[model samples]
Target: MLEVQSSLDKFKKTTGYWDFMEIGIAAIMIPFFAYQAYRLPSILSKFGAILIAIWLTCVIYTALKLKKAKPHEGDSYIDYLRQCMEYLERHKILSRKLMLWYVFPCLIGVAMIVVGQLDLLDKSWEQIIDTRMVWITLLIFMAIVVFAHQTNKLVVKKEFTPRLKKVGELIRSMEEDQVES
Candidate 1:
């Protein structure tokens, strides 16, 4: 019982910190992206800004919702554990979708930029393709996609999976105790 309470406290603290970080990052990035969109005054810039704004809005809404959440007023700590479990499950799904919204479009835009810059040196497309630069550009484009994917995997593996597992364990432990009663 003592150990369970200790673990619960630790988990709650960790969750609080995670929520803070999410909100903090969104607070910084939303305005930064908005400023970039405003400053550039281009179609691509505006589109990118809109994407970031959407991402930031989703991020802020989820983070703030999680942060402000409370267990039922008269419920026990077991209920709090259940509440946390539900919230974490929702957050995990949202995080994945949010990554798709942000990362995939951004990566595709990078690829498009590579294609767009082909004529920048005032050379014909055939002449440019004949050079080794096209191969190098392709390599860079692929690297961007691969690196972004690996980074997302590492974040989920390192930060999210562990916390989720802990929450699951706590929820089960509490449930088993409740069943025994």
Candidate 2:
């Protein structure tokens, strides 16, 4: 019994530690992406604009999801950690979506870069933007955001959520057993 109790306590502490880390990482991502948007404003190409918009949208969605999450019932450390994992999974899906979104744009960007190197287009940054490379870059960036969001959602829904739910049920059952005893 003592060993079980000690093991449970250790798990709880580990879960709590992980939860804090996940939240911290998510929180940091918002500002980092925002900075990217600000710095890359010149990416007004069609692809660039779309990428920026998508990224901003995902960031907002992530923030909202995090904001709405409530602590799990029973305050079980394991449950709490599971909740955090769910959030992280969602984020991972989003990140994957973002990556997918970037695919086309990146291809276009690469094409443009190659063309520029071959003297097919102006090589200067100003010329690149004028030639529509900005749009291509933007598109790539948006694709990246889409890839991120979708992947995160997938992990959350398929893996983390199910496992977390199972763990939660187990905890609840244990509580019930204790009550009966």
Task: Write model 1 residue lDDT over 82-167, tens digit each, in one string.
Answer: 77666556656655665476566555544444444454345687787786867886787678767776776776677567766776
| Candidate 1, superposed: residue stretches over 4 Å from native | 1-4, 70-74, 95-98, 105-181
lDDT of 2 by residue, 1-181 (tens): 3443344355446545755665566466556545554654234333343454454455445555654663454566555545654544554454455445434544454443345334533367666667665566568667766766676677557644554455556557667777999
Count clashes in each candidate, considering only residues at least 3 apart in sequence or on different chains.
0, 41
- Which stretches in model 2 have alpha-carbon errors above 4 Å? 1-129
Q: Residue 41 error for model 2, in Å?
A: 18
Q: Evaluate model 1: give its lDDT.
A: 0.66
lDDT of 2: 0.52
TM-score winner among the candidates?
A: 1
